[model samples]
Target: MSERDAPDQGDAAGPPRQRPRSRAADWLRRRVGHRFPLVARLAWDDYRHEWLVSGFSVLALAAVLIPLLVLFGLKYGIITNLLDPLTENPRYREIAPITSGHYTPEWFASMSARSDVAFLVPRTRSLAASIKLLAPGSDVGRIIDVELIPSGDGDPALEAADDEDIGSPEGHGEVVLSASAAEKLGVGPGGRVEGVVTRTRQDRLETVRLPLAVAGVAPPTAFTRDGVFVSHDLLVAVEDFLDGRAVPELDWEGSAPRPADRAFAGFRMYARELGDVAGLRAELLRQNVDVRTSIADISLVQTLDRNLGIVYWIIAAISIVGYCMSFATSVWANVDRKRREFSVLRLTGFRTGDIVWFPILQAAFTALLAWLLAALVFFAVQGLLNALFAPTIGGGEPVARLRAWHLGAALLLTTAAAIAAALVGGRRVAQLEPSIGLRDN
Candidate 1:
């Protein structure tokens, strides 16, 4: 037959079909629609027949994940408990003067005017800060030297008191003892004590005794050392006596003392919030004033939290690598055992990609079961640890807890690792030749 006139073999068969533009998408959809149910059924059959090996894979994953979750929970709980009080208490956020300076009244006024300054109190001279306390009209009198710190309105360290309790003695006569100081002096609220303040004047040290009333006792946590809190007015009185100047309220007769200046050694300042502490300190430093705050401790705690998070990620990575290796090995062995089945499926017109889904689905199911078991194990361990160690380590709080995000992350990581491992095994299964089934048949 002439080439053009002869019966065309292509025409006799049929017209050539054109492939779709999105060949990959059409192929994937066709394979998934035809084989997903078959893959699911095969996976279920494998799981039921190979229950022992499947359980082992789940247990293996749980072994690594459970301990990681527990350690993370414990560290989070312990650190939070240790830092809660320091971070929550406004008193600990105080900025105290580190060096003595002439803090004039104008300087204090300006500082107090700043929006960041919540409270401002001046400190007395250290040398002049010491005072001798004696209980009045009792053998309970014990000569004790105490530091006198400045306290006034809005002092967070001082407990709330009535107007009478906080009333000024008009001199060095009203004082609030710290809990430790009060215990040592055998005094409480509404008690009377005498103070013998000594100062140097005209190159001679002189003693001036004055009467004081104990208005209240501050809590033990208020101060790190034994001391007494007095209003700024009382502090001025104590300073006058230490300078050997006559204080009329104490009934001392001497040359009229020079008018007290507005200058102070330093001032104690409080920021409006913890977040403002660093800014306040920086501003004070720029003004050439030395300041101190608990910001250093807060920074340290935050750094530790960040480091722990890094450690957690490192641990998770290691665990995921280990689990992937384990899951891949198990799936590979199972595929090797079922090579003939995959060969038969391919011979029956199943595509390599469709056959691959069998093992992938099985791996996914295994990961799901493992994650469930791991969650159960985590909760059990959390309860056990909280019961065993909460009192000593967390002050009766839970020592371990799994936050929702943690659980979600764990599940996602495990499932992704399982799918990846299964894909690796699926590549091996896809390489099997359909001829193997025919030969075996």
Candidate 2:
């Protein structure tokens, strides 16, 4: 080929055509030319440039979150207060047999071995579980009959008693007195009392007086009426003596003591937690054992908690969906209006991935800022509500509250939702072509 004909190769393409750049590209180059990472700064600048729109988005999001926060705070506060007494105090977990039943040692062992059973002790019949107590140095005229409750290790009543470091009665000689019992005897902890047990055998009265030391005094919640918490052995001995069996332990005159496999009339039991009470009660009932418990009250509180939780979530779902849809639409429309600007960046060599981050960053910032605003507003409203309801809600408990975890969870959910909503606009940005800038201009 001739040299002139071969040289047409350079003229065929006519030196590379300069890529079209819009004013947005010139502005970006002037601001941050050849910067390693310009996506975040550009997004921020664009977000600031549209301050009015961004402000409205933030306020709209905050409006959605504030009411939800306040509603949830109220739910947590009111429900927690109602459930605290029943859950914290061990006394309310008590499960007592309605009528006497033959509960063997094996049965007691099985019941106590369960994970849900917090405490269990065998009890004697009502007739044999009474003791006439006389305070130390007092005459016989002051003797008062008090009900005896069998206690041992992990006794819920003793554990919940006001006295610290108080354990169950150690031996037959030691006993814990209920508030009424201690007051009636005019004694406190470390005091001594004379306990008298009587039996009518062979049409003759037999009386045995034993010295009892007071280990502690339980609060009124443990026992309302006059009662004494004694060792299981003492109650067994009293029952044996009343049954006319030889009481070698007490040295009371009677027949030979029965075998070691003797049955218990009933048992004192407690569940590990509020939820455990219902299942425990059901198990006992299935075994043909009738028992009394505060389950009705517990169930009422739990049901209220569950129902309120459902209602709260239902409302939250609706609000969250509405906010997300509205936010997505806003983000999408904003991207459509800024198509020419985004195309200018693309024409200037910014990749689709880089442009996609614009809306996402903006959305994340908006959500977080909204969350901050909502938190501030929620706390202010919480203080006002708490103060307004202080008189009705005793114990200085707040009427509206949110735990640390609750706020953290809310932040995570809202941030995630905002990002998801922005994805719609991000996809639109990704599809934009650099040629669109020229056509729009």
lDDT (CA) per prediction = 0.77, 0.88
State the local distance difference test value for candidate 2: 0.88
Listed in order, each prediction's TM-score against the native is 0.54, 0.81
Q: List, residue by residue over 51-152, the lDDT tens digit for candidate 1.
A: 888888778877887888788887787778757776556665788878898888788888889888888888868987778877876566688888888877
lDDT (Cα, 0-100) at 269 in candidate 2? 95
What is the Cα-based lDDT of residue 220 in candidate 1?
70
Clashing pairs in 1: none
| Residue-by-residue lDDT tens digits, candidate 2, 55-93 | 999999999999999999999999988888887677679
- Tally clashes: model 1: 0
Where does model 2 exceed 4 Å of error?
Answer: 1-51, 137-141, 161-165, 202-204, 247-253, 340-355, 393-396, 433-441
Please list the Cα RMSD from the true structure of every candidate, rounded to 1 decimal place: 12.2, 9.0
lDDT of 1 at 83: 70
Error of 1 at 24 (Å): 54
